[model samples]
Target: MGSSPSTLERHGYTVVRELGQAVLVNSKDGDQCVIKKINLREETGKGSGNTDVCDAVETLLGLSHPHIVKHKTAFADDEYMYIVSEYCSGGDLYQKIKEQSEKREAFSEEQILDWILKICMALKYLHDLNVQHGDLQPKNIFFTEYGMIRLGEFGEFNERARQAGSTKDGALSYISPEILDGKTHDEKSDIWALGCVLYELCMLKSAFSAESTVKLIPKILNGSYPPLPHNISHNLQQLIEETLQTDPGKRPLAGEIIWKPFVLSFLTARSEKSIDELNDNLVKLRALADGLEKVHYGATVGSLTGGVIGAAGGITSIVGLILAPFTLGASLIVTGVGVGVAVAGGATAGISNITNMVNQSTDRKNIRSIILEFQEKMNSVVICLQHITEGMEELKHQISLKNEQQSPSGGTIVKVGTRVSRGLGAVPELVRLLQVANMGKVAAQAARAVRVAEVATGVFSAFFVALDVFFIAMDAKEIHNIRTTKASEADDMKSKLVLQSPEATDSDSGADQEPKSETMKFVKKIRETADELQMSLDELKEIISFIPKLPDIDA
Candidate 1:
């Protein structure tokens, strides 16, 4: 229950309509908005509860994105908290889908593609900021008067109110199986919900429709949805299958989904450009695709290098002795370096391979065939890159945890830094390769590939910078400890001298105290170094964060 229209008028708004617990309110200036009343007193046995809801809403209010519904303002009374958001007169997507269902019609492939693409773009924007929509379904997707979709009904209210097992009979069909199983979720959970919505739109029916939640739970958990109609495009079918995966980690990210060939094809077709323009666009598209394949191959080779270097049996006795004291730190940093070098070297090799392959035939037909062969290798490369990136991230996490527990030794720092430096030395090679790719005729075929190469260069450069900072931090930490120990020793010497010679002059005492003053100076310098290291580490993390957004051809 919420305040009446008359009560809302006191807050400078007049209620136009009651939409469930929300009221469509018109401001004095004729601006319209929807105000939803959230009762913080409502208790939920799961999640972080009302406090989290309040915090979430506060966060959502600060966010202003074109694809996300605007939360204009909020107010509270004794019984309820009110959230005001921009009004979308075209209503929600669910209403549109229901009207189509009533007419016994399903959305065409093109229409579904367009809708999903917009949704994916919105999701990508949210996921990049580590924000989960939590509840994603057709009903939560509102349409503006211009027919653009804006994601709404989010923030803390949905988090605390919505549950897979519910008495209110909510949209359980669109709930991810992981959530139903009482597991915590992330961005991938939204993807699963998106798949359910996509399936429903294409078929004009719920993917797991049931009379009760009991029936629906098992269908979702078992991934037992009805088969797509034979007329559905194979690409769309594959996308749905991937998104509906039982394992959340296996689900493609929203950014990856946006670049799917089916979505790209739909975008190209929707452009309605002339044949010549289309051909030019296709060349750029092909280049992007090729770049992704090369990145994948590079990642694969890098992973192999890491595996070999990390393996106990693979290390030479001499090298092992050099790394023995710093195994954990050196291995992680070296592996990352290997990955960067392999990635760069792989790009150069791929360019050479392509050039050789293309040179054998001057015919356009032969060039096209070679490009096709390259595209065919992309799937394997993508999988390999995923594994490599995941492994490297896991290693970095482990190293960070270890560092938190105990400060590393000076020997370890020097060794790790040396190895990373060697790896980083490959940067010049990467730069040269990038320069060649930029200037070559190959750039004409895959304009995006050059950009990908630039990204790779930036990534490797960031990695080297991060490693350098880590080494400095570790060195500073070690120096700080050494100064502490030396200062302690100096005090002991001074005490011994005082006891041995009670008649020592004030000048002698001052001379002894000079060493202590110098030690304090070292301590101050060490603190400054530590501060610098932290700043560098923060910068490094910012750089690493960009890795996920890199142009993924396979996406």
Candidate 2:
């Protein structure tokens, strides 16, 4: 359905070469791109009624992630449609795998883990937004000149494959058992494909294969695959086994496996500072929140004390102005200044309490509002500090003016002078404490952002810890041969079922249910432990639930 090569050259692109169905091209501006030509009618054929490839292409153009190859644009001319995307120079991983196979060499564990993590990262990104890379084979994976891998050939290509019928040689090797049983693919299906990819990386061969599709179907449905090499680590073996479970319900999610202890340990050893920082920030937040609560209480108490002292002084000064003739001018000024400070401090404290209540009740869904509220609280503290400073300065000035006018004083005036001096000195210390509280507010907001990221990834720290525990259990001698244990259990169950009457067994709905495997039972226990740990963490979080609100004199 494609037109002449000259027709595409007229569209400001010069074809450098052809790579399969795609042409490597360079724009007049020196931009390198790959344009894949597809015939819409041919791919869909008659009565398929599937024309959503255009919409999928549009979606691809909107996606932009480091691990995903960028789709620049798409255009159609008559019967043929073309998609333009950024070209990767290092070719697809399928070629690399084939090369390594020829040499009879397996990839290093580090390199394999690195690629797995990258692929999962991209998958998690898409799955978070309810998007799926339906065709996620090594042939669709690409690498840059600098050796950074990226996931390409997604979106529309997957839709096209479904319409065209997936009949490519060796393609059935990666198809999950559920798909063979007439079930549609989902996120779990991607995990199954990932398992196959991992197996190839380790064994340098397909996980399942046969002379033809007929024989291959039974091998996949039976879930019988060659064991991993003895050199492979138990953790990686367990991961591969879990992902390739014939029952999708038993499969670990992409989010779960991404944070598996093996993957996490690898990332930690590599010192991925960005991930390290997320964890570090969470720890800092907990400590800062504790310190912030103490400072908040201290500030509240200080504001109350300042208010009380100021009110008492204002009342005493008014009485002094009425009774003492010589101190009339000074006492009048002190009365006005004392009343102003008392009102500002007390009102600020009251408003702060109200704001804290409102913030505590706020739903985290409105994260923008919460951040803005914290910022507003910081600003209010700055304003309150200014007001208190101004009031203190006015009081000090009036006291000095009164002393200059008067020659001598009794112990009563001496006591009053001492109290004023103490209050003035405390202002700087309170300002420092308020400033620290502001820092705590900032830390709390950052911690909230980290929480958002964790949620988006659909993983929890406790879950990872639980995975570690499960892996450690797997290292036990009894648990080492997990597949053997599973086979023995299956045999025992089958023998017990054979003893029952055939008619009764056939009619029983529960007969179709496979016995709960040992692996799944152990996993259920680990999940329970994770739930317990998460609950405990939730309790700890409640201890620092209240974000300290600063007093606002302006309010």
Candidate 3:
């Protein structure tokens, strides 16, 4: 009987009989119905018994497993909880098999197909969702009146059962070796259970039967997977053995297992199959991958074009700046000086950044990213240089508005350097007739480029203030050197003239005495050193101060 007295009057389910704590009932709605009293207070060491059941309810309500019974609805009274589910009229698969085998009744191979494949698919699906059915006895799966198979009784399902039980989650007959040996259970354990189910469906007997759970556990560990009765196909036997493999990691994934050619070959045994042909296909796939690599090589070349475009545009701008003096006169000095300062600043720092990128790049895997970074910076410097050239050209245009067009004395290839002073610092015009290139070592290319780029940016941005201050001080020292050397020379000559005249006999002769010959030579050498030092200091100050001022125009 599936329903009780009050429950039947309300829902129209006919009570048939009672089984222990549950009632057998028939749904008047022309559908099979089974209702069981739920025991929510049964505690397992994992957590609150009520908590596990609540979680299981959440999982079962959303799933539509074929081998596992679908939850229709649940309710509870003050005395007991009620669970409504589909009922199999053919009785439990377990009782039927026991009845058949005990009576020496024959089973069908065709029925085996329907039973085993469906069970395999259901197990695979549950495994994919990380749900394990701890109990996989035939009693849970039943047949309809028309012999349609249905699976039921999800209360002892593995995932929840494992949480409840400290050790085993499934029946002793079908548990995998890993779970028996206390390993963490996973999807492969489901495959092992499916193997047992397949064996039972073929043989109409339990793989390892014992009167008690403890003895049956040992029989399972020793691989007494359900007996393969005579006349079963070799393909099926090999598949079951493979699924029963001890190592879970070695098992084939479900999708891979289901579509093996053996399944198809089992239908048509004479079909040709070659291991060599599979290997050949794999080789061709790798070759096709190589062609994709070839395509990427062509892409990296784009970064090189970026470098060339940068070099050309830089030259054009600097040349245009220098031409402005003739083309614009005094206005060119103001505008040309700005353009000149910009060209020097960008070349010094901008090229250094690219050079670092080119030099530091070592790892080929990251080379593509480095190439991309280089291309972007190259474009920025190119455009900045172009703007500078344009500014020089604009000065020429303005001068042309006041007069006629005038051409520069030389091409971009000609060397140009000049020293000029402004609050923006000494702006030195440096035009390279050719590149002052430093080809970098290729061993650790990316790291070298990154390091160089970082150093260039850090020194110029973070330390520019300190550097500029140092340059200003150096300039003051050289100016003092020139004045100091002149003053010393004038005093030395006066003392030498006094020593050769009547003043030599005086008590204060120390003041009138001529300096030693070496002292006179030292004074002459200091004058020469002051002039040379001044030239070097002025050039350096121009370079340092020019770096910051170059970006004033719309770069």
Candidate 4:
């Protein structure tokens, strides 16, 4: 515990105790808190920004899972930080596990199962937000005196941690395979650790017990999970197997597991508990969505606002879009950054349609199937670019029109300033809506591009077949006429000979006609060969045409 008797006078702390690298204190109202101060002056300064602190606070605020700790408030002075969060009077899980071990008992089956399930909910929530809690273990989990579990200390979190190596400091037995193999860590790694914790809770053992980090890494990368007792339920055994899988791709996602009926049937069988967990998760997600909206809006808006102020003698398109004042709601626009909403209007030009776009979120399934998926997206990008160009042109004209109406009073420069302010006041919502449409186009492109190769192959194959058909059609009439004419000529010659040589005998006529019959047969075969060649050509061309004509989606 961190209770500094000396600094307690100034920083408003009556008590402090050093807990590892952190300082814990008792609030004036008797509430417990911890302060993990970062010495910015001594940091590695990866980017030399307060992003580290901002990211930490944002992550803590974003999680709403029951297993995660809730941050109350965080404010910093030049020297140290004061991060207030829910204090678990029951203390950390490690202490509880130790106490239980001393009694020659392990956590009950239900308690372990319940805790693991809660952990899954928390992990699912963080991943949904694209935020990751890199450090997870029994110590990070706290059991409240009120009979609750809370995940804590997620301040140094961000999109970056979602990948791995966010920090060099980490635990061993719970480490992910990627981490063990010198690969970047991601949420899958967290799942691996969750498996480790689950294993310990069940077997009362670590997944890998090693003397040092150096030895632990290799063993984890190739280690086998400790054998489970036969008494463990088949359902639980399967769940453990999925969680401990070495291949990240093969591991089950929280969504994939939580929805299952048999994986942990006992937990779900308790309808009341399951309902509570679901409700708690919903509350957490709503909170995170709110916080993220604010963070993203604030961080991205300053630049856009700055651009508004920097308008000069040249560009008018921006001025036009900025001149119309509009209300930017949070669901549609957070601090000026907006999302898509469903549009009631059928057309793109109306305010209702723009409003709909501002309210929408990116759809995920659109990117899965073919190569045209790629080209189609690219083509959409091109269409967006054209729209943007035209929109910019109209914007310039609007700016010019507004400026022209100003009186000659004051001067030209005054006119410009007024126009600049006026434009800044203009259709912010509209511009944001346009930005969102472009986003749709962007999404469409990404999904389409993902399947570009597949689309191309299919198109190419179809094109070649179409060409073969066309060539066969062109040759059909000519070949048929040639064969018919040749047959008619052979019959006519035989008839004329018969009429002019009425007196000739039957044996001499039959012998003389054999050579002529062979010639007609050869002619008919040649015509048939031509028809066959044409049919093949048509097939080849049909396949050829479709191959290179893949869809082109825009960027």
Model 1, range 478-507, lDDT digits (tens) per residue? 334434544565555444433442112112
Candidate 2 regions exceeding 4 Å error are 42-51, 155-167, 271-555
Runs of candidate 4 exceeding 4 Å displacement: 1-12, 155-170, 263-267, 271-555
RMSD of each: 28.1, 37.0, 39.4, 35.7
Best by lDDT: 2
Task: Give the TM-score of each candidate.
Answer: 0.48, 0.48, 0.41, 0.45
lDDT of 2 at 198: 84
Worst 10 residues of 4 by lDDT: 362-371
- Residue 78 in candidate 4, Cα distance off native in Å: 1.9
Q: What lDDT does the true structure give each of the candidates? A: 0.52, 0.53, 0.43, 0.46
lDDT of 4 at 354: 22
Ordered list by lDDT, greatest first: 2, 1, 4, 3
Judged by whole-model lDDT over C-alpha atoms, candidate 3 comes out at 0.43
**Which regions of candidate 3 deviate over 4 angstroms?**
1-14, 27-31, 42-51, 65-68, 103-106, 155-170, 210-216, 224-230, 264-555
How do the residues 243-302 of candidate 4 rate in per-residue lDDT, one tens digit apiece? 788888767666455533232233323322433343343333233233323222221221
